[model samples]
Target: MEQIFKWLLTVSGGVIAFLFGAWTPMLNILVALMVIDYLSGMAAASMNGELKSRVGLMGIARKVFIFAMVAVSHLVDLLLIENKIEVGYLAMSVVITAYCLNEVLSIVENAGKMGVYVPETLTKAIAVLRSKPQKEEEKPVAPSTLEVPAVVAPNPPIVTAEVKKEEKEEIK
Candidate 1:
């Protein structure tokens, strides 16, 4: 049984590596972004009382569609290589990059819809996706990492010896 499981896993991994290129950081980021987008969408929808089973399934289908696009692009890239075209994964890279930016934008929108304050950097990603300006040269920044804001009390309560003593007596 263990051997069978290992064989299945190996076959599955091989198929995936072929359908998509060997797993790389870029692909990993794309997948992570997709998951975040989907979860955020659901959260935002529930917050708005707009959650529905049908819609949720549709979202899953859309994510699968994105994966299908990636796979098709990879297949095209493979075909090009077979023909000695030597495009070097250009099609696959383009599909993945486009989807990555799209996922980033969707996540930001989902956050906004959920009444979350999107970090400035993430908002800029939308602009970078839409278009860019050549006004000034600046160092390129990586995509913004999501961080849930921590809740802090407006004013922390102070503990005093008198309060502690009174509370102890009340407990008795």
Candidate 2:
């Protein structure tokens, strides 16, 4: 049993090394944030009675995709170096930073939804990071000042109780 455990540990270590190069501090923090986000999302969903198997599966898939993208970014870094280009790990760093921020935002949102008190400053920071500046041409137009015509429908004929009673008597 000890032998099997050792083998499993060795394989897992090798896989992590190959994927992340050296298990840097930033990578570790990103992984932790991803896990926290997922768990918090599940807790929030459970609390809100909104848990669904399909949605959970999709969430897992999305987490996997995030790592896949990071790996791709690392590959891009390696490719640049291999081709004699002097680019460093900038691509990987940018990709990882973006994903980490995204995960942090998601975790905060989940925590907030679960009735946790998230700090206003952190929320504002996230909003600023995620927001994109809009051009003047892209800005939404204000409400129109023009007046609109109202459609008036004719009233329907009214039937009284006495008329109904007379009609019933005639039928009798």
Best by lDDT: 1
- What are the runs in model 2 whose C-alpha is more than 4 Å off? 1-16, 125-172
How do the residues 1-172 of candidate 2 rate in per-residue lDDT, one tens digit apiece? Answer: 9999999999999986777677778888898998999899999999999999899999999999988898888888888999998778888889999998888889988988899999999879877877898676755656695567888668967899999999999999
The alpha-carbon deviation from the true structure for residue 140 of candidate 1, after best TM-score superposition, in angstroms, is 48
Model 2 weakest lDDT span, ten residues long: 138-147
Candidate 1, backbone clash total: 0
lDDT of 1 by residue, 100-162 (tens): 988888888898899999888877866677686667866666658546589999999999999
TM-score of each: 0.67, 0.65
Score candidate 2 by lDDT: 0.87
RMSD of each: 24.5, 19.1
